[model samples]
Target: MTFAATVLTLYPEMFPGPLGVSLAGRALSEGAWSLDTVQIRDFATDRHRTVDDTPAGGGAGMVLKPDILAAAIDHAREKQPAAPVLAMTPRGAPITQARIRELAAGPGVTLLCGRFEGFDERIFAGREVEEVSLADIVLSGGEPAALAILDACIRLLPGVMGAASSGIEESFEEGLLEYPHYTRPPEWEGRTIPEVLRSGDHAKIAAWRKQRSEDDTRLRRPDLWERRGGARAQSASGARHEDRDQGQ
Candidate 1:
């Protein structure tokens, strides 16, 4: 089945931007996935089409009106009821590669792109929306995060990547950072490809790759290494949940 994606945002035109190029673009053209954008402002009831208002507790930035956001989410649900609704927020759980893989395997997904000071708190509980965070940093808006998320998901769809295993060994798939890669020139700046890689010994190469992945994860992303139970529980799989700070 096609992995359908519906995005609810104030800037509907921002979508299919970078997503319209490269692998994602190719997948979209081939019908491996689909995109639908919803303009949250379209559900506004005011003459000015206002979708945000002053923060309830007297904050500096305005907050998206819950009613307008609810309306837009409901509309998206009507069209794609099987899809899960995710609100992009800094206050949400950090997104992971495992989560992206799950979404790619599902019927589809609905993304709520927050703007201004972000969504009203009530909308999350009342609408049953799942909060998702791209990273620790903040952005001007959720559109960029949404685009990145969609790209990550789209590239995993069947037939999107040239090789089925193209994504399987990448970082996070096995709770470890990916092994370093090297290619011809064989020698660059006095550096040569690892001898084992050129030895034509598949077994040795695999062993080297696994060792590199573990060592790098332990060194570069100790957090991920720890989450997988550190060296003691190296067999652990999948992602672990972590708290997120608020972002755009």
Candidate 2:
């Protein structure tokens, strides 16, 4: 089955351009995935198709009206009933590679991109709504965050990527950063690829990669390493979890 994504936004044209040019584009072209944009403006009741309003309390910018956004969300739900509706916001859980993997395993997803200042708080108080964030930083709107999540999720879908192990070996897959990679020209500008990589020994190459990953994670993202008791222990525990789950 094709993985689907429904995006609710004010500017519908901004998408399927950047999104249509990358791996997500390839997935769409190959029928591995599909994306649908629901314009909130279309659901507006006013003659001018207005979707935003001044905040309930005094505020610096206009907030999106819940009625218009709710209508847009309802339209998206009708299109993809099984998809989870997600609202992109700064206050939500941080998006991680592990979370992307989990999302990829689902039927599909619907993204609500709030514009102007933000959405009315009532939108989030609903029973089925979920809010997700890309990072700690704020953005002009949620469109970019929606695209980011869509790209990550599409790559993990079956047949979208060239190899299943490719996504698994990427950064954060094993709770460690990815190892460095070198290509072509054995010697370039007096620099050479690591000797272990050129040796043609698979076992040695695997060990080198593992060690480099550990070093990279320890040096760059020590926080991740610390949470898992360093790289080796984390890898071992992850393997055990997989083994136990598989045996069940």
- Per residue, candidate 1 scores C-alpha lDDT tens digits across 1-248 of 89999999888889799999989998899899999998998999989999999998696999999899999999999999999999999999999999999998899999999988898999988987999999998988999999999999998988999998999989999889999999989999999999999999999999999999989998999899888875445433222212222221
User: Number of the top candidate by TM-score?
Assistant: 1
Q: Which residues of candidate 1, in runs, are more than 4 Å off? A: 230-248
* Predicted structure 2, TM vs. truth: 0.89
Please provide TM-scores, in order, for all candidate models, with all chains considered together.
Answer: 0.92, 0.89
Q: Give lDDT tens digits, candidate 2, residues 1-248.
A: 88988888987887876768767788799888887888889999989998998888796999999888888888888888888898889988888888788789988999999777888889877536788889998999999999889988988999877887998888988888999999999999999999999999999999999999989888998898897575578789899999999995
Which residue pairs of candidate 2 clash? none
